[model samples]
Target: MLTAADAELARRETRVTAFGLVLDPAALRDRLAARLPEAPRAVRVDYLRYKPGTSVLAGLVLDTGAGPVRAYAKAFTPEGAPEKLAKHRGLAARAAAGAGGGDVSADWHSVVDEPAHLVVGTARADRRLPGVGQLAERPGRATGPDASVRTLRYKPERRWVGVLGHERPARLLKAHPPARAAAALAGHRALAAAGLPVPAAERVHPQRCRGLLSLAWVHGTALDAAPADERVLAEVGALLARVHAVAPALAAGREAAPARPGLDAAAAAVGVLLPGLAAEARAVARTAAARLADRPRTVVHGDFSADQVMVAADGVWLTDLDQVRIDDPLADLGGYLAAEIADGRVPPGTDPYDALAPLLAGYRPCGARLDRRALAAHTAAALLRRTAEPFRHRHPDWPVRAATLLTAARDLLEQP
Candidate 1:
């Protein structure tokens, strides 16, 4: 007994609601195709939920038979004046064709200004694998002997299109507040000026409604696959030292604040969904915070980890500059070391104390021996942050890993 308008509204709501439900790429394709009758011939899709706070954007690749074409799609609630539907359609058509270079869908303008081009690029990058389309059709083939290119996706919602080939290092920044994007850009420039290897800034697009400020891509491979050799680690360590050496600038024109609480909050949020280790995890965070309260302040990568570090033919490139801020250097060191330890590549007892020597030698600090107490404190705090990562929509094993990190933190707290 529903009117046609009512039915259409229901359909739109259903698609939006799917964001909360478990994602099924195949099912998503069907829904998308139903909406667009002029569907491309062959299709490949990949979804990734990179981090909490960014929205999810879906990447779809269509084999137009001419060649591969990519597009990104996201949904949003209508806002602003109730203009005529035709007006909205006209605006969408212009924006889609103007910004998307005919690769984007016109339907997207009805929801938002334009689909996030960054997200679209990311999706295209993931689909470049030789058998990705085949893998999509045969789900079981995902683990087969195929050289797959990983897609980088973040949330509250982000998606990209284009082949992000393995060797192409990319940088992704969720610039919710315009200031954050500006700051990230400043940081990247600073690294480049310092003679450190970092990606050049490309573009900044504002997603007003979604509160995203997208930046240009940084090309490189995350150091996630394996621990670097001693020499590589030493070089990386030196790079970190040099990065820290750049005189602290209020790059974002923002004052520094105590980061301990932020780290605690991240952990507490994680603990909420991971009730089993909630108490212990919170305790570890608090202990780390208290211990690092007196650490010397410097520019530290707030969320540094193996994923943040990329190794490329050019050299090591650090991505994710949005979290760049003045803090204890140990925060970066600790978080990275904790990741290494958690990955089981570095034994807990293996002393990395001397590892800094080569790095320091390379950096040639103005003063020998940077503050160790503060470094250790920041390290502890970094571990706490890692232990408290949000688990919603994350893999089932994530919480287990968080719990394991909590255990490691507790052990570190007991040391000396």
Candidate 2:
């Protein structure tokens, strides 16, 4: 439940509709005047709405006599007040306080939670911008869950522009939890340091809230957009091989697997909304679990697929490291193969053995070969898990697509 004050804050944050009906900036100013006893002169107010992948955010830039203050706001509507917004503000303040200018690192202290209000810290000028210029020149747009509420391209002078948030009711997906998002960001940075072909990540902004982690934009075409050429495939294979080389280590004495969520738990949550398909999905998951139990475990890209990889002039730069986890390496291979087949990149009747060759040619197996049985099981598991995703349910062809993939896995399992 939102307090009266918070509710009012959200209402003030609603963006103007696309029909040219603008929000009354004066009225909002009046409200703020009453809230803040200082009654600073509001010079200008612009409601900049941004959709990052799947999350919709409105940034309220209040130019006042005191200074320019920006607030990144997300509205919950009937979902009530978002639990993470205040925390995000607090974290942002902390990050800004401690972060020095220049260099890419996790700027974790930018959030601030005061007794009277919450504030997300802003980066002051004097910071060195590493990849901002390259990103700005690339002109990339993100949709789906990968969207950002506000994306900033930092320059040496701390200059930035907030792109993609003008319309009202923008839809954006909540980012993965902060810890996992950070880990994933850290993983990408680590890979880049090791000279692996991965997106370079400099923590532009730390976790201000539980779900908000801002990262430097990587410029490249998604793997799905790249031609299925030998070069592209080889790049992906090499990138994954290098990532696998960095063995998993315990962070602070707790073994950190890749930041991927539990497949069983995700499936169970999906089952609640899709009761009719629960039994079959659960059974498929069980079979996958049982089979995977016997396979060798290794570091893997938990959500490997064509869409997750990006092709660039330099090489394949993998993004979305948030899903990296320690699991049967076969699971990653199976997932990518299953996605390729379903997307019609590979012929329907193509034998898994033949498909494995090119994939492995680039991947360069680190150790023991994953048997067909194990691959089949892992592929089935990946399909079941993906089908249970919330976004898949929204797609009209999801059920049919899921069923088809399941059948493919079942056929493979029954053959040998």
Top of the candidates by TM-score: 1
Error of 2 at 30 (Å): 30
Off by over 4 Å in 1: 1-20, 23-152, 157-179, 202-227, 250-255, 307-315, 342-344, 347-376, 388-393
Worst 10 residues of 1 by lDDT: 116-125
lDDT of 1 by residue, 1-416 (tens): 22342233234443233343223434444454544435445455433332223233444455654344454444322331123223435433444221111222222322322221121221212222212222223212222233222333423223232222245433332323333445655666766666667666533223322222333464556777645555665567677776677677644453357766776776666554455677876777677677767667676666677777777777777876666777666667767776667667566544445534444454444442555545555555655666644233333355566666676667767766
RMSD of model 1 against the true structure: 11.0
Number of clashing residue pairs in every model? 33, 32
What C-alpha lDDT, on a 0 to 100 scale, does residue 385 get in candidate 1?
66
Models 1 onward score TM values of 0.60, 0.54
Residue by residue across 85-138, what tens digits does model 2's lDDT show?
A: 454554344333222212111223233223223222222211122122222222
